[model samples]
Target: MTSLIIGVLLVVGGAMVGIALDRSLLRRWIRNRDPRRHHPAPETRAASSRRRSARHAIEDAERRVESAEAGQLSAETAASRVEASLDALQAGLVLCDRNGRVVAQNTAATQFLQARHGEALVAPVIKDLLEQARSGELVTTRVELHAEPRRSYEVRAGPVERGGEMLGAVALVHDITEHDRIESVRRDFVANVSHELKTPIGALSLLADSLAADSDPEVAAHLAGRMQIEIQRVANTIDDLLTLAMLEDESGRPGARVDVGAVVAAAVDRISETAEQNDVKVVLSNRTAATAIRGSRLHLESAVFNLLDNAVKFSESGGRVDVVVEADQQALTVSVTDEGIGIPATEQSRIFERFYRVDRARSRSTGGTGLGLAIVRHVALNHGGDVSVTSREGFGAKFTVTLPLDSGD
Candidate 1:
């Protein structure tokens, strides 16, 4: 009986020990799996905390990547919008590196390249230009291009910088052909005016000195007459100058609506004396009645008289000079036809230029100041019109002045 009791006690003790070890193992498993579970050992708890922190950090990094991608897309969209806006401008634009290599260019730059014989668009013709610009050289120059129809351009180059560091260069090209032409015309006008004024002044001075020195009444009288002629020439030149100045002034001045019939009649009457003196017959062809033009009376009369006078002076003796004034709803045309020693083709283009004469000797003999046609041109232009001439050498000449009818009328 004592041996049996010892065996049972031993069995019960073994079962209790086994059950307690299984419970400790289950608690350890729960601590490892559950994040909120605590450990009795400090080292084990710190290791678990480190693992949890590492996992959280990994997840945060993934979220940051997604946000960065979204921001990157927004930035790219804004850049695209900026590029599109620049492309719509009319002016040509180019962005280049400091070495003159093209980075970007607009559509106008492409068109300019194609127009200039397939030259590389946005590329520098000379690398020195880029280098100078990078060095802060603000240079401007006029360049003539041999493109289709030809062109004149003003090119200006300057440096582009950011944050005090040299970035690159920019070149701006502007078409200045019309401006150049206007400047050329201005220079020519000044030179011509100087020449015209000097001639009459010199002639008057010489004639006056001769008259003062000549004691013989016949010689003095002849010199005085020559001086008077020079004075008249000077006066005529001054009047033409003043008239041209007035016409060129941008100020709008009121003028009378003179009857076209009266203007023609007056012009005919004024030129009849000159025609008789030159032995040329004047013929009038009035096609339209009640024809009127809006212009200063003096200007219209002077322009018409100049045309008739030119016809009479150039015509041969007994040659017929025809004057016609006609009008339609749109415009009025005044034509003066003369059978004369017609102007040469080469000289016709320059006849209307101030002080330009086809035949200087003939012009002097006919007492022409060389400003009549010029005056006619200015008057026509001021009245929103134009004058044209057609002449065949040794045949005849026809001058036509066309003026637009008043819009309100």
Candidate 2:
């Protein structure tokens, strides 16, 4: 009976121990499968999630850093291009910020700062224009500065705006000195041409009427001669007007080589008859020189001819006129010296002007067109040369022409 009782107790104990072990294993499996049932599993999962999140945050930060670097490079490139574009403009350009303060300027814009009197005239006006632009008013103005050489400038500026917001202002300055000069010359030319033409035309009309009305042979002959003279004067005036206009319109550079010595000789020949009629003697000197220059042959001949003719007509009887040609390494010079009625000092400044004459009565009597010296000036300018006169009243006058030495070979 004791052995039986001991066996039953052993079986019961073994079965109980097996049930407890299985229950413990099942509870562990449930906890591992379901995160809510086990707190330690949830903690492990949370640690892994935090690590992933940290890695993702690091990647996102790297992407943002790269984007910022690219944006900076793009901005720098755009700024460089803007600077280059602004500097290339021919007209002066001034750039201002929204506050109307000058932030950037081009090389040409700096010239306004360097100028003496021009700055005073230009800066204040520009500032005013800019301020006006800030008020949304577009302004354009031309300012004439009476400086040493005299200058004219056109300024155009206005506000730059987008989306109803004023961004800044832009100013453009253009130098118009040459244009103003051309306009002044044109006005003077038209006035002079009309005055000169009307006088000759009126004289011709009166002389013709007198010739027609007179019946006496002697009177008729005198009237006819006078009419002829008046007609010639009219023809000369028209011819001169045409010539001056042609010269004014000529802008092409002379490409042909011209022998200045040859030109002088030709001019002397053309004026020799007139010189002899006036009892004036023309003497040539220094003709055997290498006086060659790049010039228009026709224009040069005309200039020399006019000079010689003027010298002859202004000279008194038995006076000697000298024609000199000289050449050196740097220049070719031609001088016409006349021992005749000379120009007064006060008239020197206006000597080269068109239709200007020191002795109006004498010029008219001699059939002078009053455009000879002006023609000479135009020809000199065309050839990149200059002409000057040295004279004193009642003394001889010397007219000198200088041309840069250019190889005509």
Candidate lDDT scores, in order, read: 0.77, 0.83
lDDT of 2 by residue, 147-217 (tens): 66678899888998999999999888888888886787678767867877788788888877887887889
**Candidate RMSDs in order:** 8.2, 8.3
Candidate 2: Cα lDDT at 59: 99
For residues 1-409, what per-residue lDDT tens digits would candidate 1 score against the true structure? 2221111223474563222334555667777998555434788779989999999999999999999999999999998987888787656666678777767777766666555453332234323455678788987766676655556766667889899888899866666777876686678778767866787789988888888787999999888888888888778778888876676673552466877668878999989988998888988888987477677778878888899988999899989899998988888888999999998988887788777788878887777877889889888887788999999999989999988886316
* Model 1 Cα shift for residue 69 (angstroms): 14
Which candidate gets the maximum lDDT versus the true structure?
Answer: 2
Model 2 clash tally, residue pairs = 0
The alpha-carbon deviation from the true structure for residue 13 of candidate 2, after best TM-score superposition, in angstroms, is: 28
Worst 10 residues of 1 by lDDT: 1-10
Question: Whole-model lDDT, candidate 2?
Answer: 0.83
- Give residue 67's lDDT in candidate 1 (0 to 100): 94
